[model samples]
Target chain A: MANVRIERLHKEFRGAGGIVHALADLTLDIADGEFISLVGPSGCGKTTALRIIAGLETPTSGRILFDGRDITRLEPRDRNIAMVFQSYALYPHMTVRQNLEYGLRKRGAPRDERARKVAAIAAMLRIEPMLDRRPLQLSGGQRQRVALGRALIRDPEVFLLDEPLSNLDAKLRVHMRAELAALHQKVRTTMVYVTHDQLEAMTLSDRIVVMNHGVMQQVGRPEEIYSRPANRFVAEFIGTPSMNMIEGQVRTEAGRPLFTGPGITVVLPRDAPQALPSSGRATLGIRPEHVSLVAPDAPGAIPARVTVSELAGPERFHFVAVEGGSIIVRTPAATVLHPGETVALGFDPDRLHLFDGTGEDAPALR
Target chain B: MPPRNAARLYPLVLLLLAFVAFPLYWMASTSLKPQTEVFRVPPTFVPETWTLRHYVELFWLTDFGLLFVNSLKVCLVSTGLALVVGSLGAYALARFRVRGKEAYGRLVLLAYMFPGALLVIPLLLLFRQLGLTNSHLGLSLAYLTFAVPFVMWVMRDFFASVPVDLEEAALIDGASRLGALWDVVLPQAVPGLIATGIFAFLFAWNEYLFALILISDESLRTLPPGMMRFVSTTDTNWGLIMAASTLATLPMALAFGLIQRYLVTGLGAGGVKG
Candidate 1:
């Protein structure tokens, strides 16, 4: 219902460590009805950003504009923003019906209207059976639904969720995650979700903002982020079994760039040799799925020995040892590969992710 | 514990219980006996004939009723005042991020360390300047000197245990800070309030030093000091004193009996308020 503009938010907390930067010069604009996610590891400032948006936290210096109105100093109650805490902070003393109706009652809705809205929300959440039960009496999943219902019944301009499904069991988390996607589709409210889980951000968000150390690493659609990460941090942090990196030096061989690491050498593809830094030292990044296992003598493939093999559902992962480093190769479960087996690794030429440096801040070579 | 091991401990428990219960048993028994049986050569464990004569005299022969009303008035007012002021102060201390709040909390508890015997003289001098001597209101305020800090210390632990997330949820749901407290925080703190309230009540009810020093008017005396009238320098009315003592202890016994359930969990829930 409302577009949010965050203009250069900076938050610092004076702690035992002395001035921990919780957030740093964060500026983002969320369009109306877009479901955006702030995804990062723990202490990465994702939750701090969400709280700042909810007005629960005051930034050291920033301005928040909602629908073109400055509301940086407005109280949380006056901002018309609702948040579902990670704990699902439902009122333990109130029944589900009362919890759902709390916001409406605070806004002074009539008795009949409040009752009607509670009934409708309870039905939508499929929690009608729990309407008379307090939060303590409800199961984990039911408490989650009640918490969601409490926020949804408010019909606020912005809905904020802070890792709302983290407390549920794995199976329940998936089920609720799907239900949340469906709910967002139906309501289409401007929602900003904060989570440390990458899958949740990838599946549920219109755009994913990956963060690290209180700074935005990259912000793009889920596929764009996965396929074209902006830096070394995002490249390694996004994918499961994480992208593999080889610390190597780049040199020009016969007018073409060649990368040589401890035990392997790779010819760089044409088109972006200029993207290589002047120092010629860079990190080569590649995903497990993108690396192919071929016959030991296959042409242009790096020979390696499998150190470990793991069978995970439909895919098998092999931790293969190359000349001086190791790489994980994910292949079809049907392809049986054993430890100590000799094989060769083939890098997908188009899928190669080359970073100009080995540091976390190193830029990706496009 | 196993039933056999527990059974072995019963005798020691019974002996301790008897040590505590015997005085109360004698007070009730002596109150029911006639004046003739009070000073018998061999003290009777039970009255041969139970009579209400002493009970009647406790009301009609003296100002026991006035003293009872005065004790109730001061205790109730002080407990109420302490709960209101202490719980708010405790909640703020537990939840807010004010600078030097830790020092402030420690300072408030330091007020309780000064015993009434140590403080009674200064309090009386200050009360005299304020023209509060010989008044029930003055005694009520005197009780708060200790009662408020006690409540604040205990209830701070209780309020801290109530999750901060609940209040944040309430604020986002459109409730003001105090509204959120009333609707969410206080309800969760009910057992703490009850436990702290009883302690404050007991402190005010049993205190003798302050009541004795602050109020000299016989008409305004509370039970602790008022009970002295029965003990004359030449001879004391043992029968009347026992009857008054039994009656004085009844209200507290009834209060504890009704709220023992909350007192157990509430007192234990704070873990270590020390």
Candidate 2:
């Protein structure tokens, strides 16, 4: 096992029209035996970062250190990393046993040792019956298992998985996610996983690195990033149904800061500091699950019209028309609210997030 | 309901059958006819007397055996050389992002498109200056100008159909690029190699122009030019010529019959999207 360190990595492709920046000054440290998931939107350099770590691609300028040794120019085989591609990439002409044995044979391992390792991995992955079958005869799930088995049989210093479950059906993806987590636990190797699915990042990662446009936005545990997002992008990206953001001005009303917009007004917490710039522009961020519908006579309530209601399992999401744009609130499915109905939407002042005019500023809880 | 479609196809099928079967039947019938009834004007479809005189004459009275052996040697050598060089070049073109890769590919196609008839005289001159005329080596070199390009272009297209991921998987498994190609990629390309080999073989075997120009010795002549030797200023022996023609075509017919299944499967695999 080895710890992989990347410092100030940058990659650019010279295309016909102009230079396309794939990765820009990325710095990350992956500890030995830790699973790190790099999550981002498409074209956000997640795969490029993984490829650089695997030594399959070269960074335009940077340093990659493995176990305190510089290895930026090493070949993929010399890097001692096994990568499982998104397509499974199984050798169609070879049987499962041969596929698993190929890496060992190339490494010049002894025959008995190679056979022993193959048998152990096949038993661990429960793929013993598939050992004699070619890739085409296997189903999608079986192919994925064989791909994982092929990587595991090598027993390399690091395991790199690039969206290995993206090709499976939805149900199989869930099942394989758990299986992968179990496999990682059993092996305890340094793993660098890349995926665009946020749930996969949350479920499988010891630490999740959220990136956007070739830049790392935040890195932390799932719950820490969910509760304390570094900026508006993380706040808007990590949650389901996304966070409702409303732009307004921050003004003092009777010595207490109050956010006032066109069709809505809300009182801020009394002890909240007035540290925001006097740009008179800020955005209020609140998750849909944080907003609640209450009786009209209740204290600290804002009146709004219900635009639509969608039943999602036991919870119903109500799209309420408030000042600037719509705010979604999750209520009980038993709630009898309909379109065009007037209701009082209640939310705690402490749960509100206040940000400056620019979306990049750190969010301050009100 | 479909009687009209069947009726429409009958004449087309009949025309195809007649066009294909007529020459074969005539060759076979004439090979058995006596030398006297060969041009009986009425053209007997069946001979009154069958004879093995032509076959006997061809082996003993002529150098047909030597010509057959010469053709086989030249065709086999040329086909083998073409396959080895073409497969190596094609694999490089298929996988490597070398400088001027597209130019190299277009150059291969251009070589194939070049007219062989125009190059014959210059090639003869070059071969004569090098003391290569009337040599098997000269004929093989001339044949490669056409055969290599055909083999390379077809094999390049064949290799392109195989997924790069398969080779990458092998590379990750500790194989070098060439090793991966030999172990994984070439196994999938067996059918293609066979098909390309057959084409190269046929191209060299049936060539008449260069063989006529290069080989002055009757013993060194290939099947096509050797068959033409039966014609002289005084008379054209139709019976002997037909027998020799039938003899010359036997190898090609057997070869095609042997590899037709593999040719179809190989071409179909390369043609289909992976």
Candidate 3:
């Protein structure tokens, strides 16, 4: 196992749309035996960063170090990194056994050794019956399992997975997610997984790296990314229903600082880390589940008219129109609230996130 | 309903099939015809008297054996050259970031569009100056000027259809870049190689104009030009001509037969993306 370190990586692509700045000056350190997930939207450079580390793509400017050895100029074969592509990329011509043994044969391993390794991996993945079958003959789930097996059989220093489970059905993806977790535990090799699904990153990664448009927004534990996002993007991106955004300003009213926007005003605690800049531009973010629904007469409540109510089994999402944009508050489905009903939305002071300024001066929150 | 549609389309299909088969049937029949039955006002659909005297005389008495050997040598060498060079060229264009790739692809096909007839005179002179006239090597070189681009373009389009990820996987699996191509990319490209090889072979095998101009030595002439030797200024022997034409077509038919199964499968290669 080897710890991978990316130092000041930059990559640019030239296409018909002109130059695409796919990755900025990004740096990351992945410890040995660690599972790191790079999560972002499409074209967000998460895959680019993974490819650079795999040596499939070279960075325009940077060095990739494996266990403190500079491997930036190494070919993929020399890098000792096994990648499981999103499409599985199983050789259509080869049988399952052949696919698993291809790497071993390339390295001129003994035939007996190759077979023994393939047999062991097949038994582990429970795909022994499928050794004779072609990739096309296998089902999607089976192909994915074989793809995983192919990577595992190599026992490379690092494994790079590019959305390996994305093509499977929902249930299979979940099942394989657990399988992958178990496999990682057993092998304990360094892995860097790239996905656009934040949930996958949250569940599978020791550290989740959130990126957008070629820049890393935050790097932290899953729960930390959820509870303490680094910026507006992470706060909005890491949650399912998405965190609520209320564009407001910090105003000094009667010698006390208050967050005021539209029809809502709340006094800021003295210990708040985020403060309004001289431009008086600031935004407050709160998760949907974090916002409490209270009676209209409740203290510290902001009045809002309910626009819609959605049910997800026992949980309810109440969409309320307030401020510049609406915020959805999560509540129990048993709660009785009709559209257009006047209610109050409350915020947890400790759970709130605030950002100051815009553009380059925008504060990346803690 | 199926019977009704078949009945409606049957006559047209039969007519088209017969129209296409007639010329080939006539050529085969004429090859078997005895000299007395060669010109009996109208052509015979089948030879009343079947014989192989023309084949025997042509092979033994005429320069047929030398010509046939020369054609085989030239066609095989040129096809081999084209496939080897073309596949490498195609791989580069398909996988690498070549500057002005679109223009380069179009420029490759432009060599195909430029008429072979236009190049004959200039090529003949160049061959003469280079002491390549009257040689199979000169003729093969001329064929490559047309064949390489055709093979390259077709194989480029074919190589592009193969997923780059497969090659990358091979590369990551202890294979060098060329090793990956040899193990993964080339194995998947058999159908394309066969198709391109057949085309290049046929182009060299059946080509007449450049062969006639470049080869002046009777011993060095390929099948097409050598067969023309039967056509004297006074009279043309239709029987020998037909027999030689049939002989010349045998290699192409064998090539198609060898690759027929792969043709259907290769054309349907987008089936398993994973």
What do the candidate models score in CA lDDT, each in turn? 0.92, 0.86, 0.87
> How accurate locally is residue B195 in candidate 2, as Cα lDDT from 0 to 100?
94
Q: What TM-score does chain A reach in every model?
A: 0.98, 0.94, 0.96
TM-score of each candidate structure, all chains considered together: 0.97, 0.89, 0.94
Which window of 10 residues has the lowest lDDT sum in candidate 3 chain B? B265-274
lDDT by residue (B149-194, candidate 1, tens digit) is 9999999999998888999999999999999999999998898999
Candidate numbers sorted by lDDT from highest down: 1, 3, 2
Candidate 3 per-residue lDDT over residues A1-366, each given as its tens digit: 999999999999988899999999999999999999999989999999988988899999999999999999998888888999998989988999999999989889999999899999999999999999999999999999999999999889999999999999999999999999999999999999999999999999999999989998889999999988878888888888998888877777776667888888877666675445667778878899889987778777898889999998989998998856798999888986799998888898878887775342255443
lDDT of 1 by residue, A1-366 (tens): 899999999999987689999999899999999999999999999999888888889999999999999998988999998899999988988988889999999999999999999889989999999899999898999999999999999888999999999999999999999999999999999999999999999999999999999999999999999999999999988989999999988888888878888878888788645656788889989999989977667767899999899999999999999986899999999989888988889988778888987898788988
Candidate 3: stretches off by over 4 Å: A358-361, A364-366, B1-13, B128-131, B264-274
Best by lDDT: 1
Cα deviation of A193, candidate 1, in Å: 0.7
In model 1 chain B, which range of ten residues has the least summed lDDT?
B265-274
Model 2 regions more than 4 Å off = A250-262, A267-280, A297-300, A332-337, A348-351, A354-366, B1-14, B17-21, B44-53, B125-134, B214-220, B269-272
Interface RMSD of candidate number 3: 0.8
Docking class of 1: high
Q: What does candidate 2's lDDT look like per residue over A9-92, in tens digits?
A: 999987678999988989999999999999988988999998888777789999999898998998777777888989888988
